[model samples]
Target: MSDMRGEVILRVVPRPADINSNGHIFGGWVLSQMDIAGGIVAGRIAKGAVATVAIESMKFISPILLGDLVSVYAHAERRGRTSVAIRIDVVATRGGGAETVDLTSGVFTFVALDENHRPRLLPDA
Candidate 1:
């Protein structure tokens, strides 16, 4: 759906060390990846330090087992003077096949900050 404000930015397969005892990718691991991927886009827009201010509606639709390639997509859904709301989607390929199934999704809000850690004007797009 084009209306969905998300884009695939990074893709990687989890290693055995990334999995929890449940044999699925750890939630923290996935969240960190999302943060990293989300930062890439947010930084360009913010033109400075961007801090995560909020996370909403995170849903893990399926377990991501080790060796399954995971894809993370993030997009700017809303923008303000010093903040941007981003949507992140995580998907895992079932096999070596091209098909992918969404595993997690959430809205992450980031605020642009200056060197002193205060909200700053967003650089022009």
Candidate 2:
């Protein structure tokens, strides 16, 4: 799926190590990658460090096998006083085809943190 209304924050192709025995990408790997992507956007929004507080609505819709290039995109869906709600999407593509399939999707929440690790208010979204 394409985010015509938003911006792309992260794009990556999955490697063999990213696949699980079930022939799909490992859930942890996907989550971690998404977390990294969220941090990228969150840091820019916070103008400093940010910590992941919660991840919700995580749902796997399809499978991703070895050699399947998975592209993950993230964007800020909404903003709160000290937090930002981010929507992340995973897309997979095979060499035989030119199209990409939506594998999974979810929203992540993070809190802006100061240099001393205390929670700080984020800038406007």
Choose the strongest candidate by TM-score.
Answer: 1
| lDDT by residue for model 2 (1-125), tens | 45542556666777777878887778898889889988888788888899999997899888776777767788888889888988888777877567677788889998999889988888765
Write out the backbone clash pairs for model 1.
none
lDDT for predicted candidate 1 compared with the true structure: 0.84
TM-score of each prediction? 0.89, 0.88
Listed per candidate, the RMSD to the true structure in angstroms reads 1.9, 1.9
Q: Compute the lDDT of residue 4 as modeled in candidate 2.
A: 47
Model 1 TM-score, all chains together: 0.89
Which stretches of candidate 2 lie above 4 Å from their native place? none
Local distance difference test scores for all models: 0.84, 0.81
Location of the lowest summed lDDT over 10 successive residues in candidate 1: 1-10
Q: Candidate 1 — which residues are off by over 4 angstroms?
A: 1-5
Q: Per-residue CA lDDT of candidate 1, range 8-125, in tens? A: 7888988889989887889999998888878878987897789988886688888888778888888987898899988888888876866778788887888999999999989888
